[model samples]
Target: MAAPSAARSLLLCVMVTAFLHHLQLQIPPVATAAAASPNKTDGRDDGRGKTFSLTLYQHETINKTAYMVVDGVTGAGVSQTTTPFGTIYVFRDDLTVSADRASRVAGVAEGSSITTSLDGLQSLSLAKITLHGHRGHRGSVSVLGGTYNTKPSDYPVVGGTGDFAYALGYVRSSPLDLRGRTVTYKMELHLYWPPYAHYAPVPHKPV
Candidate 1:
């Protein structure tokens, strides 16, 4: 009788322990992460109408004369290709486009298109950009033709492929230095792209 009584008491204690454990599991003591975090939203648009700035360094090669029509005066298909080394900035973020001499052509300009399309325009260009690692359209940058040197040029950012699919904006190019046959230019590109705005191909338009 004594042994049975002891056994029953032990069983009661065990059952009580299990009941307490079950109660603790039903009401966990941990606080939710969301509730503990500060209440603040990310301060950026959802990629629509977003603007970016690129500070590009262009080295007009010694071969620019080869594409010159009248030795840098004017001619059809007179285009110059420059290799660039610089940084692209988005607010405070920065990325390097300069690379292991892969010899990326920063941009191309044709004097003939400028001369024929726009009347009597001196110091102009039919600017088409192509940068390595640039979000250009289908492996090419849609043409951006305009007078990009009128007291510091502001050329349109027509259309692009890759990340710049329906890209729109302008590029302001200012001369940084002139070295004999190699000129250096600093181009500030202000870019904007919108959703569903890309893929809408347009006819050739002069700006």
Candidate 2:
């Protein structure tokens, strides 16, 4: 009887050890949530008044070419020139990037606050440019549209209600003559979103 009892105890210990090993292997998948949730914005899971940060970038890549007349040219003849192209800036915002939607039914909308970073300019910079969201598509293009220019400063803040809605930034890339040289440039773009949505409770309540 004693021998049989000992054998049973050893069997139970082996089973428990196997179970512990399995649990150890399973830890990584669970820990992944703590690393970083994708598309999550700052101040998420917390109340309002939480300010986040983003990057406002602009770059110009030459694409295609067209000809135009250069000013102050001699003789009665036209001159052809290659067009230069580049984007001044671009903005992208995702409202409700991070929210405790699983806790409530009502959602929140993120809005944009016009921002600029001018001191970052060196010299001989172009005049500040502005954009109108409403004019683009009757306010359909972006939730809030306004002017922006070259500068190292905080970008605009964009948030809106509903589960999903995008107030996209405009893309401006057109050929322009700079001192007789044809050039193209695109507008800068930045995106901002806040977590303010909630999820409906399970077990629907009959109305």
Candidate 3:
């Protein structure tokens, strides 16, 4: 009988110790995490009507003087000529376009959703995007083209014309109406060289 009583007491003590240990484990220990923040640009007024820029770096080995077009369909085709590196666009969150418009180039289509189309553009939302590439020769490479796939972040309450421009290319066109409604836009721009070439003339004797 005494032995049984002793075993019961020992078991009770063991259970109590385990319960206390569990309670200690429930408490979280102090932790320190060192992580970098994501890159971001200053959002304007109310996360709308803000202009931003993106830079791209490129390098390619081309033997001929051909133009590459960075295509933008609705938005301005920012990259005008073949540049090794430069600013691409000044995307405005207040800008947008209609649902249906004939594509500048065939085969290339716009993104269905506003968010998807603006994916690349939003990457520049934080700040200036720097594109990198190998340095070789001028006119050796060029930006070809791109298409806009998304709508702007915000639009005027009363439908009105919104104007924007591409920073890289001087191409400008506007009078776009964003009638108080949020709509997505797609930009498709292209790169190409002139068919003709110019050369210095040499004097020759006529016979």
TM per prediction: 0.45, 0.27, 0.16
**Which candidate would rank higher by lDDT, 2 or 3?**
2
**1 or 2, which is superior by lDDT?**
1
Which pairs of residues collide in candidate 1? 136-161, 136-162, 137-161, 137-162
Model 3, range 105-133, lDDT digits (tens) per residue?
Answer: 11211111121132233211111111111
Candidate 2: lDDT of 49?
21
Candidate 1 residue-wise lDDT, 1-207, digit = tens: 999999999999999999999998898555553243222221143323344446555544444422322322233232232211111101111112442223455444322332332223233354455554444422223444444322356666666655556667666656555435655556666565553224223323325
TM-score of 1: 0.45
Q: lDDT-based ranking, best first? A: 1, 2, 3
How does residue 127 of candidate 2 score in lDDT? Answer: 23
Q: Given candidate 1, what's the lDDT at residue 186? A: 62
Off by over 4 Å in 1: 1-49, 62-66, 70-121, 134-140, 143-145, 148-150, 195-207
Query: Tens digit of lDDT per residue, candidate 2, span 25-53?
Result: 87767445544443454433222222222
